[model samples]
Target: MRDASSGNALSDTMEVNDETQAPGASWLPRGDDWVLQLSGAWRGQRAALPELPAQDFNGAVAVDAEALRSWDAGLAAQLWQQLDPLARRSVTLDLQGLPQGLQEVLALALHDAPPTEEAAVGPAHGPLERLGERTKTWWADHRKTLTFVGEVLLSMGRWVRGKSDMRTSDLMWQIEQTGPRSLPIVSLVCFLVGLIVAYMGAAQLQRFGAQNFIADLVTVGVVREVAALLVGIVLAGRVGAAFAAQIGSMRANEEVDALTTLGVNPFDFLVLPRVLALLIVGPMLTAFGAAVGMAVGWLVAVGIYGVTPLEYVYASVESLTLPHVVVGLIKGTVYAVLVALAGCLQGMAAGRSAQAVGDATTASVVQAIVWIVVAASVLTVVFQRLDF
Candidate 1:
């Protein structure tokens, strides 16, 4: 067939490469010039240009896209792949024969301009600007934390009113996990700590012939500070990480979303029970750990040291006052709240992946530990100020 526009006929039959199915390309001879013909809808993931022929074009080539109905970034990418090398090798590209939009796009793709000065150096920020940016990030993070805390408080209020989705069974299970099951480890740790305290105190007190004072040291130290602090650290590692892992896995599986779709508040169903369980069980554990530690201290004092059992018992009883026990219980309560908050916050904010769940679990443990320590320090300072 003759070309009607310029009366020039295609002399050679060019077939589209089989690899490129729909949006294909072929080199057609139009008079003395070679026209690269592009046809079909050059869009979507499957659209691609044909493979480059082994025969190199020494002369300029014209792009004939009159048959192309539509195009997208995929076509632009393909055109760049096929035409960039030829242009780099000194072959001129006649984009005028292509669509206006395609021609303009190709111009940008084929250009070899150097980077502008602003782009090369980038925007400079002073120390004040950097500080402002950091402050903004800090504010954003703390705002999210405060919002989560407020939501948790509201959930607790709802539970108190008996209008929440929190289950009695879930609370009992969490209590069992954080309480009785944790006793062996807590007992072992507190026993070892008491042994060390009693041994060290006896070693120093023997020089002064005041072996009876070892009872005072063990009782005051363990009940007022050591037992509560150790229990908090233990639970931060044990229970806090477990909460994060459980909730994060639920988040990854879209179970949290499913709960929300069912008009259930995840805070009520998931977080409140864990927090309440810890709140109820933590003080009990702290008191138990303190009693265990004091008993071990008594054994060490009366067994190894020459202090009489009656004298050691009398000293320990004198040191174990109401204020000391109250302080330890209060610290345990605060640590429990912090642990629950850290674990639930990280789990709820977790991303939807296995790695993300693992990361959230790790972060929850670290955050719980840090919060426990900070709260301990603050409580210590306050207690000291009050002369408790």
Candidate 2:
């Protein structure tokens, strides 16, 4: 071959590496600087470059732009696997004249930023800027989370109102279960209490030559304190535990989610009934406990102390006032609401886990006890100021 500008021979050859060659083929070259391409073998093979023709016009070998493009594209495809991403990227950018796709890929490589690696061992101040930025952003980023505290307060309100509207099933159950069923125990305990008080009082009174006054002392103490405090304590355990268990179970089963999906108010559906029921049952139970306690005192006085029934009745009439009964009932009702509210609130606040439920239950019991003690003390002070 010779260039028209100047007569000269040209040489070019295509060679394939053994790894890139066709199956079961041997490579051989047959030409001067240009040889017939062998199928495979890198030992004596290399792709020939475009030969310099006799003239600088270079007519020795024809170059196909499309062929070079195809070759470049193939090389680019393997870039990612063969080189570090940035290195591959640099290569790609250097060869960006290949195609639109290659250009985009190269641009992506150059512009792409790696996530800053969190170094287990690095410069101490490397993270200082990020931490400072976050601290600066903390208020803005966490505004919603902080505002959610207000939402929790709102939740408490909704819970309180919901409790106020509870269905009577639990409340009625408590009354029927706590009061009616507890009557025998109350009566027995009250009687023994009365007997003990009478004995204790009479022993002292007899020393003072006023044994007949034992009935008055037992009647007054039982009515003024024991009935109210005992009823509140019993309700704290029974009703408080029930409220926690009920609400906690619903939370565990995703009943709260069901309520959300159904667009039903969970507070209205769950808490209201219980709250209202307690409002109704509380005073009644207190009265029941008080009556039984008084009867116990009577039995203790007349049977054990040998106090005449007429004398017992007389002292009770004189010493036991209406204020005592009224105060007991009022305290019981208040305590009932406090305990129920605490239990339900804690339960509803529980997370969706067994441990959460247990935590809620424990918190509910503790809160109920605290509320009861505080309420009792407050009521005592208030009543002492007003009635005593």
Candidate 3:
């Protein structure tokens, strides 16, 4: 930098705050170079400082702050705003004349400043890229679920060998919760479903003077499909959500970690009993729901539709086959397993927070319902193909 004392005054100093002399800058000629003179207090937004000289900086430039009494970031900002463009234009800058602190601030600002132009945007993802990302996410989620299922299976093996931590009392409590405690809602729903089916069937059958056949329709439908589906749906909403919330809350409180520390298999102690309880109760509930639905259908047919009670009973008896009952119970078992798996998987993988427990509970219900529907469809298709 050219010495500020050796520079020749080129123009009168531009006074920004003449009354207070808040801060100002001036231009001077130094042979083939230029000198910027700064003076007065330049702290914060105390007062406006002089605008940068309009003259072009086509040679080496030096900032001279010998008269700068005190300053702050405000001064640094002004210098950057004014001198950054000149530096980009290849003007040799010598800021040594400024205070060391100000020089450092200016150096950092100039080094990290964003480009004057707008940044270019990245390209949009193609269909293949989006598909790949979705596939990866799907695999990640299912991998966790599969791992949980494997753990459950191993726990089941230990259970069979009488080496599991599953408690008989726990299993019985779960059975009470999943079976008897659930009967009221299951009965109400199935009865209403039966009433609807019977009414719909009677409406059409009455047209043909064949209202007696309403028993056949309701019996076959309820026993083979509706009862199991309604029971599964009820269990998914009630039992599945409960399992998730219980386990997830345990996880949030670090009880699951405590179990691991104590050498207890969490899957055995927490999950297997619940799963076994559901397995034992699932078919029983399906049968109960079927009976409730069939009874309600008989009431609708006999009392509302004026069909002969004896004929309705006879038709229902004729339509109720062992194969249909077996298929419905099998479906119930599968749905029960799926609901338990979904709930336990989400709970075990949940984050350690109340919100995560809530999310796991919600996800368990949703996943159970989805799996039940898919399983129902697949089972129906396979049974049809096999003539079962």
Candidate 4:
């Protein structure tokens, strides 16, 4: 007979003996049991056994492999194919005649197989559930941020007590990064801003024949606000992003974890130097920016507004008081702290991926800029209200 599955003759490899028959299997009904009989060399050529016909039998099905000469996983696989049909008819298998090794192999294959689609049922989530999950995640993030801030503060306290593990060289290097290297950009931005202010003030004042006041406008604006604000924004984009990318890469490479494993506080070893450097550099940059801005204003007033060089210098100097410079420096110091904290916090929290480092760098710059604006607004209001 032709095997329905492979369209091959079932007796192709069968050999008949004078007193016994060649290898094959036969199914027979015996009362409440189904007996499957096997015989001969059930290997190699016999591996491509025909699929079993679907049956509607009840009770137990027993395999009889005693007369079999040899077998392999192929035979085991063929036998396994018969199991599901028996299971569908509520029949239990009697695998007593199967070799222990074959039985174990079959058992393992069945055990590791993925669950059927019917077994993967799950409940669906509602919109409220998703919203609650998001809220919880946000709260957790805020809590972690506050904890990081507290750790940084504690590190600073330890440094003040002369018990910090931070290296002086690291502090110096960070100061160089945030200070001298940044002067050109700071000076350029301040000078352009001063020129713009002088041009605008001269335009309005010239209409009223008071163009000489352009010096006062540029001086007061630069000393009290514009120069410091411009420097803060520049550093936020430059130093803050650098800090975030550097620390985020270290986090990704597990170097920060290594420091922790070695009993070194990352807040002290990594964060303190950055914060202290920015704090020291912020005022210095602000002062330099103010000077450059005043020089630019002098140029505008002398060259464009028909004011004498000495008179422009005197008006610029007279327009700025110590209190105005002090306020600018204070704003710079606060802006520096905000920028450093934003970068460091985002860096330490970065995930272990290239994309995450980039994201943290972007976030650091954005957060630093936002905090600087907010700080400047609040400080401006307070300084004005106090009549400074």
Per-residue lDDT tens digits of candidate 2, residues 1-388? 2474243221221223323442221212223221112222222233332222321110121111222312343333343232223231222113322346654664444342221222211223547875765564566434643453344445447766754333446456655754566556555655566566666777788777776887777777777777666666666676777777778878878998898788766666666555556667777766766667667767766776677888888878888677877777788788877776777777677666565677678877887888889998998999899855
Error of 3 at 304 (Å): 1.8
Residues 1-388, candidate 1: write the lDDT tens digits.
3356334322221234323335767877655456789877666757456665543444566788877767887788788778766655546569987778878888866664222322222223677765665666568778989999999999999998989999999999999998999899889999998889889988999999989899999999999898998899888888999999999999989999999999999999999999999999999989998998899999989999878999999999998899999999999888888898999999998777676789889989999999988899999999999998
Superposed Cα deviation of residue 30, candidate 4 (Å): 43
Compared with the true structure, what per-residue lDDT tens digits does model 3 show for residues 22-101? Answer: 67678788877888888777776555545545445446878998888789877787788777766544456799999999
Candidate 4 per-residue lDDT over residues 23-126, each given as its tens digit: 57787777867777777766663545444443544457777888877777678878766764443233566777777887676554443222222222211156
User: Which ranges of candidate 4 are over 4 A from the true structure?
Assistant: 1-138
What's the CA error at residue 171 for candidate 3, in Å?
0.7
Q: Clash pairs of candidate 1?
A: none
Candidate with maximal lDDT:
3
- Assess candidate 4 and give its lDDT: 0.81
Q: Against the hidden true structure, what lDDT does model 1 obtain?
A: 0.83
Candidate 4 is scored at a TM of 0.67
- Best to worst by lDDT, what's the order? 3, 1, 4, 2
TM-scores of all models?
0.69, 0.55, 0.69, 0.67
Score each candidate by Cα lDDT.
0.83, 0.58, 0.84, 0.81
